[model samples]
Target: MPAINAIAADKLVRLLGTPRSPAMIDIRNDAEFDAEPRLIPGAVRRAFTSIPDWAPDFGDASVIVVCNDGGAAGHGAAAWLRQAGADADVLDGGVIGWVGSGHPLLDTAAVPPRDAAGRTLWVTRARPKVDRIACPWLIRRFVDPHAMFLFVPAPEVAGVAARMGATPFDIEDAAVRWTHDGELCTFDVMVEGFGLGAVDGLARLAAIVRGADTGRPNLVPEAAGLLAISLGLSRMYPDDLEQLDAGIAVYDALYRWCRDATDETHDWTSHKPAKSRVRA
Candidate 1:
């Protein structure tokens, strides 16, 4: 049985990629981190000794504290966070337990530098359609929940990235590291770059994104539908940010479908009486 105020690794995996997942704070010491520099997807590193300073940043968001062994450091930091009025729990077995469960860990080296507020800032072409929207959704949901995006004119992407200290993505510049690679879209590159390719549904989602963004919707039936929705969204909002905000929900549903509903099928006949249903 798990300890009080502790969550098991298996249970945590179920919540990791979803919007309802708790804020994950890695409290592992520097030595422990340097030894194995990977993180649970979406977890942000925080110094356990500085818990008093950062605990309040979580506000009322539920949090799960992680350490090297799901030991004292995790429990202590969680306790401090709770004392600060944030709902907090310790990971039952910490990073070791999570790895033991065969879950994928994010590569910390792939993460870009954060700004003063600890949020990754990205600049991309304005009036984004498919890949642009999908890439941001993946980053926010799996990499940095508080990541910020700046949509600017195509010609200004590199300049804005330099001036604003934002990473430029989904552009054709030879210097940009987050753009397309061969046949894959930016979303595919990010999933692989972040070590998220092995996560349950991301590979399938990446294929759909690649297909839709590359005008080869035949790659997956869902790709065509995604393209249609993305184009419609692009037309719906004159403001790029507004379109991105709306596109977030679209990808959320697609991801859920990829993760949990791929095997399931739906039709009006599914609810119809067996006797009344048409026999093909």
Candidate 2:
């Protein structure tokens, strides 16, 4: 049994990509981190000794601390965070447990460098439709919650990425790692590249995104609906960022439905056969 103020690896895995997920603080030292460059999805590296100072940065959100093992560092950081008046917990067995449970961890070393403000910067063609929006949703929810995206002209993507130290994605180029690969859309590429593909819910959403983006709405029944909503959203907001803000809600709903209600069905009436109550 785990100690008080500690969360089991399986429980944390179930909460990984949801909004209810705690603020994940990776407190592993340099040697511990070098042993495995990948990180728990959406986790940020922070010095365990500095918890008393930076713990408040998390505000009211619950925090989870992790180390190479759940021995001293994780417990110490959680204790400090609790002393700072925040709800904190230690990963029961740390990253080793998370990994041992077969949960996907993001490969941080493969991502682009962060800006001085400590945010991953990305650039893509403006006026996004499907893959573009979906990729950002995945990034924000599972990679960097504070990641910055630059929507620019299609012709300037390479230039802006080069000059601004931003990772260019969803663009047709050899250097971009988050673009299409044959039959897959950029959303599919991101889901696979970021280790998100293993999540069944995300995989379901990726299939829908792929169907809409690849001009094959027949791939999934929901693809046509997604395309329609995406087009309407593009027309509703002239500003790219505003459109993205609105789109995020739509995707959030879809993701939850994919996770929890995919098997549900809807009909005009709850009646069956002779029990029909609402007009035929």
Highest TM-score among the candidates is held by which one? Answer: 1
> What is residue 24's positional error in candidate 1, in angstroms?
0.2
- Residues 1-280, model 1: lDDT tens digits: 7899999988899897888989999988899999889999999999888877898898887999999998888888888888889999999999988988898899889999999999999999999999999999998888999999999999999999989999999999777899999998999999999999888899999999999999899999899999999999999999999999999999888999999899887798977788999998
Candidate lDDT scores, in order, read 0.92, 0.86
Q: Candidate 2: worst 10 consecutive residues by lDDT?
A: 271-280
- Candidate 2 Cα misplacement greater than 4 A, ranges: 268-280
Prediction 1 global C-alpha lDDT: 0.92
Q: Write the per-residue lDDT of candidate 2 for residues 117-141, one digit (tens) a residue.
A: 6789999999999988998888988
The model with the greatest lDDT is 1
Global Cα lDDT for candidate 2 = 0.86
TM-score of each: 0.96, 0.91
Checking candidate 2 for backbone clashes, the offending pairs are none
